[model samples]
Target: MTPPILTVRDLVVTFGTREGVLTAVNGVSFDLYLGEVLGLVGESGSGKSVTGLAILGLIDPPGQIARGSITLDGAELIGKPEEELRALRGKRLAMIFQDPMTTLNPVLRIDTQMIEAIQAHERVSGKAARERARQALARVGIPSPEERLDAYPHQFSGGMRQRVAIAIALLHRPAVLVADEPTTALDVTIQAQILAEVQSLAAETGTAMLWITHDLSVIAGFADRIAVMYAGRIVETGSVVDVLETPIHPYTAGLIGSVPSRNKRGVPLAQIPGMTPSLAKLPPGCPFSPRCPRATVTCRTTMPAETPFAGARMARCHHPLTGEPLAA
Candidate 1:
C-alpha cells in the first residue's frame, strides 16, 4: 500500500471556558493518502471544524491542541512555531474555509491577493504569478478570468467569491487540503461544478484532501472514505460503500437513515433522538450514550474501544448494530 500523505493520531483539542476546559476533539485519528478524498461527517458542534483547524495550526487563543500528533509527510506539526507552520500552511497544506470572505481580502483586488499568495512561497515574477493566477480562475470555471482578476472581493457574487477562494487554495497544489464546507452556500449547480473541479484537481495533483461536511449525500459520490464523528470523536470509519451500506455505529446508522432518499414518500424524516451532548460536560462513559438507543449499562459507564472489522473499517461502540440490514 502507498504511504499516507497525512496521519493524525489521538488528536485532542480543548477550549478554555468559564465552566471548564472543554474537550472539543477527543482522541480523533485518521490517515489521508495522496489523491484521495476523506469525508469527515457529523452534526454541528461535533468538533469537525476544530479537527481541521488543529491540523492547519490555526486554533486561536482560548483553544489549543491539547494532545496527540498531526504528521504531514512524516514531519511533526504539533508544537511547531507559528512562523514555521505558517510557511508550511499555504505551500504544503492549505484550507478552504466555509466563507470566502474569511479567505479573500475585501480591500485588495483579486489579482493582488493571488499574486502575493504565489510570491509568498516562490520566487516567481509578478507577470508569471499573474499568469498562473489567471489560469487558476479559468480552471475553476470563472468567466473572463482576466477581467475578474482586476475586481475586488465585494464585486463578485457569493458563489463567485467562493470560487476565487478555491482558486487561491489551489494556487500552490498543496500536498493536503482541508476544505470546511466550502460549497455549502452555493446553489446546487454551482456546488456540483466546484465539487467536480476539486475532485479533478486532487486526482491530477495527487493532493490528499479532507472534506468536512454534515451532509452524507454530498460525500457519497465524492470521497473515497468516510469517517463519522460525534461528540468530538470518530465513531465509525470505512470506505464510503462499506459504512453507508452497513453502518455499524448507531449514530452512523441514524445519520444515514435521516437522509431524504432513504425515507418513504411523505414520511417524517428519521432523526437521532436527542441533541449532541455538551463537550464541556460529557458523560463519564460514552458521550453519545444519552442519544444512543443501543446504550446499555456498560455503554453508559465504560467507553468502548475501537473495534476493527474487515475492509479496514472500525467503530467505537459497546453494542454496534453490525450485520443488521440498514434502512433503505
Candidate 2:
C-alpha cells in the first residue's frame, strides 16, 4: 500500500492556566492518504479543532503540543522551528478557518490578496499570479472571476466569501488541507456545492483533506472515513459506511441518532444526555462515562484502550454496542 500523505500518532495538546493544565487533545492518532477526506466529528470542546491546529503548528503560547508526532509526507513536524513550519504552510499544508474573514483581509481586494498568496512561496510575476488567482476563483464556481477579483471581501455574500477563502487555500494545491467547519453557517444548498467543489479539487490535486465539523450530516456523504471524537479523544473510527452504520461507541451512536433525519417525523430528536466533561477535571478513567449509557463500573474505573474490530474499525469502549439500529 502507498504510504499515507500525513500521519498523526499519539498526539497530545495542552493548555496551561492559573487553575491547572487542561488537556485539549489526548492520544489522538490517524492517517490521511492522498486524495482522501477524513471527517473529524465531535461536539464543541471535543478537541477536534485543537487537533487540526496542532497538525499545522498553529497552537500559540499557553497552549502546547505536549507530546506525539505529526508527520507530513514523512517529515516530522513536532519540533520544527517556526520559520520552517511557516515555509511549509500554504505551500504543502493549508488550513481553511471556520470564518472566511479569518482567511481574508477586509481592506484588500480579492485579487491583491490572492496574488500575494501565490507569490509568497513562489517567485512569480504579479500578472502571472493574478492569472492563477483568477483561475482558482473560477474553479471554485465564482461567476465572472475577473470582476469578483476587484471586489473586497465585504462585498461578497457569506457563501461567496467562503468560496474565495477555499480558492486561496487551493492556490498552492497544498498536499493537505485542514478545513475547520468552513460551511457550518451556510445554508444546505451552498454547503453542498462547496463540499462538491472541494471534493473535486482534492481528487484533481491528490490532496488529503481533514474536514472538521460537528455535523454528521455534512460528512455522511463527503468523507471516505470518519473519526468520532469525544472529550479530547477519538472514541470511534472506520470507513464512513462502517462507522455510520455500526457505531460501537455510545458517543458516536448518540451523535448519529441526534441527527433529525434519523428520527420519526415530528418526534423529539434523540440527544446525548449530559455535557462534555471539563478537560481540566476529567474523570479518572473514561471522560465519557458520565454521559455514556453503556458505561459500567469498569468503564468508570479504567479507560478502555482502542479495540480493533472487523472492517478496519476501532472503538474505545469496554461495553461497545453491537448491531445497533442507527436510523428510525
Candidate 3:
C-alpha cells in the first residue's frame, strides 16, 4: 500500500444555525492515496458533503472547522490563510458538484471559463490556454471539443455540461479531486460512461479522488475503498469487497441490505428504521443507537471506541458482527 496522498484526522465542522450550533461533521477521519478513489457514502445530512467541502476550504460563514487536521502532500491545510487556500483550491485541490451548473457559468463561454481556470494558476498566453482547454474537453470524451468550446453552458445538454465541468476540474491535474455525486443526475448509461472515464483519468494522472455519494451501487465498481458515515461519524472503513461482503457495523450491514440490487425481484427493499438525528441533539452515547438493531445497553449508555480488525479495517461499534473481542 502506497502512502496516503491526502489525510484527514479528527475533522469537526460546526454551523451556528437557528437550531443552535449544529455539529455537522464530528471527528471524521480518512485517507486517500494517489491513483485511488475513496468513496464516502451515506444518506443525506450525514456530513459526507460537509467533509468534502472542508477539505477544499469551502466551508464558510457560520460553519467552521472547529477541530481537525487536513494534510495534503505533507502540508497542513486546516489553518492556511484564505489567500493561500484560494491559490491551492483549483490548482492542488479541485471539486465538482452533483449539478454541473454549480461549476459552469451559464453567462460565460466554455472556452472562456477553461482558459481563465488555467491562466489563474499559470502565466500562459490566451492561445496556449485555449489549446489546453480544448485538449481537456477531448480528454473527457466531449465531441468536437474545438467547436464546442465556443458554446455557453445552456447550449450543452445535461451530460455534456457535466463533462465540461470535469474537464475544468482536471485541467490543472490537481493532486486531489473531490467529486460530490457528479454523476447522480445523469442517466445510468451516461453515468456509467463518466464513471469509467473519470476512473481512467484519475489512474492516468495519479490523482487521489474522494467521491462522495449516498448511492452504494454508484461506488460498487468505482472506489477502491469505502467509508460508511452516519450522523457525522464513520462506522466502518474497509475495502469495498470486505465491507460489502461482511460488514461489522449494523449500520453498514443495513446500508448494504438497502441497496436495490441486493434484494431479489418482487421483494421489498430493506431500510434503516428511524430518522437521522438532529446534529444539535445527538444521542449521549452512540449517535446511531436509536436505529441500530445490534445496539446494546452499553451502546446507549457509553460511546464505543473504534475496534480494529484484520486488513486495516475499523468499525465503531460495541457488538460488531465479527466475534472479535472489543478493545480494552
Candidate 4:
C-alpha cells in the first residue's frame, strides 16, 4: 500500500465561548492516500468542517487544536509556526471553501489575486505567474481565461466564482486539497463539471483530497472511502461501496435511509429522530445514543470502543446494526 499523503490521528478541536470550552472535534482520525478522495460525511455541526479547518491550521482565535498530529508527506504539522504553515498553504496544501463569495477579495482583480498567490511561494516574474494563473483558470473549465482574470469577483456568476476559487487553489498543484463543500452552491450541471474536474485533477496530479460535505449522493459517486461523523467523532468508516450499500452504524443507516430518492414514493421521509446535541452538553456514553434505534442500556451507560469489522471497516457502537437483522 502507498504511504498516506495526508494522515490525521486522534484530532481534537475545542472552542472557548462565554459558556465554556466546547469540543468541536473529538478523537477524529483518517488517512488520505495519494490520489484518493476521502469523504467526510455528516450533518451540519458534526465537526466535518472543523476537522478540515484544524488540519489546515485555520482554527483562529477562540478555537484550538487540543490534541493529535496532522502529517503531510511524513512532516508533522501540529505545533508548527504560523510562518511555516503559511508557506505550506496553497503551495503544498490548499483548500476550496464552501462560499466563494467570501473567499475572494472583492477589490482584487482575479489576476492580481491568483498572481500574488503564485508569486508568494515561488520566485517568479509577474508575466510567468500571470501565465500560470491563466492556464489554471482554463484548466478549471473557465472560458476566455485572460478576460476572466481581469474581471472582479463580483462580476462572475456563482458557479464561475467557485471555479475561479478552485483554479486559484490548483495554481500550485498542492499535494493535498481539503475541499469543504466546494459544490454546495452550484447548479447541477456546474456541480457535475466541478466534480469531474476535481476527479481528473486528483488522478493526474496524485493529490489526495479530503472532500467534506453533508451530501451523501456526492460521496457515493466521488469518494473512494467514506467516514461517517456524528457529534464530533467518526462513528463508522469503510470503503464507499461497503459503507453506502451496507452501512453498519445506526447513524450511518439513518443518513442513507433519510435520503429522499431512497424512500418509497409519496411516503413521509424517514428521518433520524431528535437533533444533534450541543457540543457543550453532549450526552454521556455514546454521543448518538439519544437517536440510535439500536441503542441499548449499555450504549447509553458507557461509550463503545471502535470495534473492527470485516474489510477494515469499523464502527463505534455497542450494538452495530446488521441491516438484515432489523428487517427481520
The TM-scores, one per candidate, come to 0.96, 0.96, 0.97, 0.96
- Candidate 3 residue 245 Cα shift, in angstroms, is 0.4
Give stretches of model 3 more than 4 Å off: 323-328
RMSD (CA, Å), each prediction: 3.0, 3.3, 1.3, 2.8
Candidate 2: regions farther than 4 A off: 323-328
Q: Per-residue CA lDDT of candidate 2, range 1-328, in tens?
A: 9999999999999999987998899999999998899999999999999999998999998999999999998999999999999988999999998876556888989999899889889999999999999999999999999999999998899899999989888889999999999999788899999899899998898889999999999999999999999988999999999889878888889998899883468899889998988887899888899988888899889988888877778888888887432222
Error of 4 at 194 (Å): 1.0
Displacement of residue 299 (Cα, Å) in model 1 is 0.7
214, model 3: CA deviation in Å?
0.5
Runs off by more than 4 Å, candidate 1: 323-328
lDDT of each: 0.90, 0.91, 0.90, 0.90
Q: Provide the clash count, candidate 2.
A: 0
For model 1, how does the per-residue alpha-carbon lDDT over 30-142 read when each residue is reduced to its tens digit? 99998889999999999999999999999997998999999998999999988999899889999998876566878999999999999999999999999999999998889
Candidate 2 minimal-lDDT segment of 10 residues? 319-328
User: Candidate 4, residues 1-328: lDDT per residue as tens digits?
Assistant: 8789899999999999997999999999989998889999999999999999887899997999999989998999999999999999988899999987788999999999999999999999999999999999998889999998899999999888998988888888889999999999888788898899889977878788999999999879999999999989999999999999888898999999888883478989899999999998888899999998888898888997777788778888777776332211
- Residues 1-328 of candidate 3: C-alpha lDDT, one tens digit per residue: 6778899999999999987998889899898998888999998999999999999999998999999999998799999999999899999999999987566887999999999999999999999999999999999999899999999999998889999998999988999999999998999999999999999998888888999999999998989899999989888999999988999889988888888873467899889999888888898899899998888789898988777877788889888887474344
